[model samples]
Target chain A: MSIRSLADDGATLVASGLTSLQRAHPDLVAISEEPAYVIRAGATPAKVALVSGGGSGHEPLHTGFVGMGMLDAAVPGAVFASPTAFDISTAIRAAHRDRGALLIVKNYTGDVLNFSIAAELAAEDGIATETVLVDDDVATDLQRVDGAGPSQPDSHRPGRRGTAAVIAVEKICGAAAEAGAGLAEVAALGRDVVHSSGTMALAFRACTHPGDDRPAFDLGDDEIEFGVGIHGERGVEVRPRAQAGELIAALTAPVQEGLGLGRGDAVIAIVNGLGAMTGLELSLAHHELDGYLGARGVTIARTLVGNYVTSLDMRGLSITLVRATDRFVELWDAPVRTPALTW
Target chain B: MSIRSLADDGATLVASGLTSLQRAHPDLVAISEEPAYVIRAGATPAKVALVSGGGSGHEPLHTGFVGMGMLDAAVPGAVFASPTAFDISTAIRAAHRDRGALLIVKNYTGDVLNFSIAAELAAEDGIATETVLVDDDVATDLQRVDGAGPSQPDSHRPGRRGTAAVIAVEKICGAAAEAGAGLAEVAALGRDVVHSSGTMALAFRACTHPGDDRPAFDLGDDEIEFGVGIHGERGVEVRPRAQAGELIAALTAPVQEGLGLGRGDAVIAIVNGLGAMTGLELSLAHHELDGYLGARGVTIARTLVGNYVTSLDMRGLSITLVRATDRFVELWDAPVRTPALTW
Candidate 1:
C-alpha cells in the first residue's frame, strides 16, 4: 500500500528537513548521528534535562520544541513509529548535565514501553531519570471490554491518549526546570499541568499515511469524525456535520466536564489545528468556543490558536483547556525559542 | 459562490478572536474602536511607524503581524476585501507619533487604490506618509497589450502580483524602522527586499468563498492549479499532478530564475502553506526544493516552513526565495513578537 513521497527515502528526507531547521538556528541547536538532536543552551541552565520524542510526523512537537526553555533534547523515530530505546538513552546521555534527566512521553503503548526501557538503561548508566506521562485526550475515556481478545476489551480504562496538551506540559516543566527545580519537582509540575488540562478533536477528513495511497480512515461529504485521534484512528462517533455553534459546544462540553471547569474559573484555551485546518477555521472555532465558555461563565485568561499539534495532513482541529494557576501562567509566559512555537 | 463558515457574522467572529488574542498578551496588544488595532510596543520603540492591512480572510497577515519589530497597526477589511480609506487613515494617525508612517501594501487593485487614498488623506492632516508596494508574484507577469479595452490588448507589463513575499518586506522594514531609520531609509530597504524576492504558488484544491457551497475553481481529482493567485483567482495552468520532485521543481524553478539566484548565492527558502496544506506536505515540498536548489548550487542560508501567509482553506503551498544580503539576514533573525511570525 505504498503510495508516493517526494523522496523515496523517508528517513533521509526527514534528516535533511531537520538539517535545514538546525541551519536556521545554528546558535541554539545541534543535530547528531544518534538520530537525535539537543538544544545546546538548555543543558547548562537547568537542574533537570527534559527529553521527549515519539514519531516524526508530529513535527514541532518533540523536535521543534527543543530550545532554551523547552526540551533539552529530542530523539525522533520514523514517521508514526517509536524511537529505539538505545536512541532515547543516547539522547539522555547527550543532554544530561550533572543533574538528572526527565522524560516527557505521550501515552501510547509503544512509546510507554520504549521510554520506560530507556529510563532503565539510563539509570544503569548512573543517570537518575524520571518520566512524566501525558494522557490528556478526553476522547479515549470510553470504557473497554475485558477478555475479548486483542480486538475488544470490556470494563477497562484504556487510558487517555495524549495529543496536544503535551506542549503545555513541556512549556511549564521546561520553565520550572530552567528555574532550577529538581527532577522530582519538574515531574510534579508536569503532572499538575496534565491533570488540569483536557483535549478533544474532530477531523473533516482522514490523513493519508506516507507511502500509502489509501486514507487511514474515511468520512462522507456530509459527515465528520468526532473525537478523532491524532494517528487517524476511528473516533468515538461519526456524525453528520453540525453548525459551528453546535460543533463547538459538542467539543467543549466534554473537555469542561472532564477538567471540572466551572463558573469564574480562569483557563488557557488552545484551539489547535490537526494538520490541514486553516488559520481562519481555527480562529472561527476559537471565537465560537470563547462565546460558549463565556456564556457558561468561564474566564479565558490565555488563548493560543494555531497548528501546534497535527496529524499529518488531516483536516481537523483539537481544543485544549488548561486550568490556569498563577505559577502555570508565569511559566507559560516565559520566553522560549523553538522552531515552531516562539515568543 | 461561498462556502459555509462556523460563524455567520464573520466580522463579529473575527473581532472576538482578536479580542482573545489581545487577552493573551494584554501587555503587548490592544483593540480600539477605530475599526483597527495597534501593537502597543512598536509605537514607542521606533521612529517611522510601520502600518499595513488588507482583507480579513488572510488571517495573521496584517493583524497577526502587528507587534514589536513588525507593524505598528493593522486595519482589516471584510474577507478578501480592501480596507476603506477612512479606516486606513485612522490607523495611520493612531500609529503616528511625531515620526512619519509607512504603509506596506500588497499590490492588488483595491488595496493599492485604498492605501494611496489614505496616504493622501494623511498628508492633508500634516502627517508624512510613504508607501512600499509589494509586487513579487511571478505568476502575474503577463504581457499587457497597450490601448486595449479593460478586457483585452497587450504589450504592457501588468506588473507582478504581490503574495507571500510581503512578509519578508514587512520584517525587514519593521526592523529598519525599529532601529530608528528614517522613513525613506525604511522604504528603500523594503523596496530592496521586494526587488530581490519572488514567489510562486500552487493549490491542490480551491477554497470556497464564505457563504457559498461552490469552490472558487474546479480541478480534477488528480489535477492541481499551478501559479495560483492568493485571492482564489484561476492560475495560469491546470495540469494533472506529478510526483513530488517534479512538482517542486516546477514551482521552485520559476522563483529561482525570477530572483536571478545563482550558484554560491545565499537565499532564504520559505515554503509557506496557503491555509490547509499540512506541515508534513510542506516539509516534503521543502525537502524536494532543498534538493532542487542544492543541485543548482544555491545555498539556502535560512529556511522558514509553515503556514505563515495563507489563502484561507486553500490546500496549496507557495515558495518564496529572498536573495539575502547581510542586512536581510540580520533583520530576518531579529526578534519579532507578532501573533503569527514570532521568534
Candidate 2:
C-alpha cells in the first residue's frame, strides 16, 4: 500500500512521466505513441541497437538511459510488471537497424520469458537479435535450508536475481556498441560484465504498492532484511539492525568473495540506493564500504554512489562491484549523455 | 532520531565519503587538506572561478558539484551548519585567479555572514571577489502575522530561505564564468537567475539529525508540512495530506505565482526530491506539474527531475521553475561533468 502516492493511477503516472522526460531531451529521445518505448531520437544506426526494459518502478534504469551513448530504446510496463511481448517486439522493430538489436534482460521469470518471446518475434520479422541475461545478485547466491546449520548448495537455489549491476552492463555495452561493436561483441561484453560483477542489497523497510495502504511487508523498529530482492521478496535473513560499518562489511564480504577480488584488483564500485534512502546515508555507507574494501587490499578504481536503480519507495540500498580492466575503465569513463546516467 | 544511520560521527562520515568521491574523479576534483574544500583539479586560470558551499548534509549541492563545468571549489561545513569564514576564505584564495572569484551563497543567515566575511578577507588578500546571494524559496515568500493570512510583505519576514533554485544559479553562473565572463557579469547572471526563479518544498516526514534519535519535527500519518525549509524547519502551514496531483498543484501554485510566470513563457522545471522520496513519486509529481503547467499554457523548455538537492531523510519534494531565455537555456544545456548535476 502506498503511503505517499496519488492512489490508483500508476500506469498513467509512468506514461506521463516518460512524456515529460522526452519533452526535456527532445534532441536525444522520443516516446512512441503505441506500446510506448522511449526511443533515442538521435541514435545513429552505426552499430547494433541496445534495447533494455522491465517494470516501471526501477526508473532511470532502462528509460532514463535511452540516448546516444546508452540504450537505443527502453520498453516499460506497468509498475513492477513485465512488458508484454507485443510491446517488446514493437520496441525492437523501432530500434532495429541494419546491424541488429541486443536485448539486456534481468534474470526474472517474467522478463526472461517475455523478452525471449520478443526476440523470437523480431527474428521472424528478419531482425536479428540476441539476449544477455544479467544475474549478479549475490544475496541469493545460496539457497536456504529448513532447520539444519544453514548449509545449502548454490545449485539448490533459483538463479541469483538481477539488480543494480545491470546499469554497469548497459553502460559498458552501450559504449562498446556506440564504438561500432557488432551484435556479438556487444553481447559478449555484456556477458563478461555480468560475469565480473556482483551485487547485494538490504532493505530497511518495505515498499508499499502504489494503490495499497499496507506496506508490502512488515519490519520491526530495530530489524533489517539482508540480501533482499528489489521487489518485496523476503531477504535471505532478517536480523537486529547493525551499524552502517557492520552492514557494509556483511554486504561487501559476499560481493568480494563472489567476484574473487583481492589486493591490487582494480574495480568500479556503485553504492545504489533502493529508493527512500537519504544521500547522506548512502554516502556514509559508501564511506564504510570504501574503508572495508581498502583494508582488504582492493584498489577502488572508480565509484558511482546514488539512487541509480530503485524499488519504488523501499528504504534500502545495494552495492555493485565490477572488476575493472583498462578497456573496461576506458569504456566506463566514455562520455554518456542520458537522462539518468550522464557524464 | 536517525532511523537508518549508524549513530554519531557525522563529520568523519562526511570526510571519508568525500575522500571516496575524490578518489573516483581524480582527474577532475580534489579536496584541500586543511580547510577541506572540494576543488576542481584541472581548473585553468584563464577564467573567473565560481565557488559555492554551505552545510554538509546536502550532499552534491556544493561539493558534488565541484568539477570541470560547475564549481571551481566547494567548501563544506558540518551537517546543516554553515562553514566558517576562514574555510570560505581559504576556498576563495585557492580558487581565485587574475580573473577573480564569484561566490554563490545561499541566503541562510549563517551562510550569508560567513561568506560575506570571506569576501572581505579575500579582498584584503588582494583577490577581487563578488558574492551572488540566492533567496528563491517562495514558500517563505511572505511574512506570517499572528493568526492572519500572509499579508505582510517579503521584507517583514527573515527573507526567503534559499533552497533548490541555487542549483540553477550555480549552473548558469558557472557557464557564464567558464565563457570568460568577468566577476561582475557572472554575479549579474546569478542574480538574474535568482530573480527569475522560484521554488517551494513540502515534507511528508521529518528527518532526524545524525547524532540525534528524535526527528527534527513530526507529522501525523494523514498530514503534511507545506512550504518547508531545507534545514528541517517547520513549514508555513500544515495540511491534511493529499494525492500526488493535488500536492503538486499546491507546491507549484506558489512557485508559479512568485515567479509571475504565465502563458507561453519557457521555463526549466526542476522536480527535486527532499531525500527519501522515491524516483517513482518524484516522477509522478513531475508529470502532474508538467500537465498543470501545460494547461496553463506554459512551455517547459527543460526538465530536471531527481533528488538533486536534499534535506537529509525528509520524505518530500520541491519544485523549482526558472523562467528561461535563449541564454539561460543555453547555459542550462551547457555540458557539466560534476559528481552530481552532470550531463
lDDT of each residue in A138-240, candidate 2, tens digit only: 8776443223223556566458788899998889999999899999999999999999999998887887777777668888767788788888777777767
Q: What is the interface RMSD of each candidate, in Å?
A: 4.2, 2.6
Docking quality level of the chain pair in candidate 1 = acceptable
Worst 10 residues of 1 chain B by lDDT: B143-152
Estimate the lDDT of model 2: 0.83
Note the DockQ of each predicted structure.
0.43, 0.54
In angstroms, give how far residue A340 of model 1 lies from its true place. 1.5
Candidate maximizing lDDT: 2
lDDT of each: 0.80, 0.83
Model 2, residue A316: C-alpha shift (Å): 1.5
Task: Candidate 1: list runs displaced more than 4 Å.
Answer: A1-13, A33-43, A143-157, B1-9, B41-43, B142-151, B154-157
True contacts kept of 1: 0.45
lDDT of 2 by residue, B177-199 (tens): 87778889998898999999999
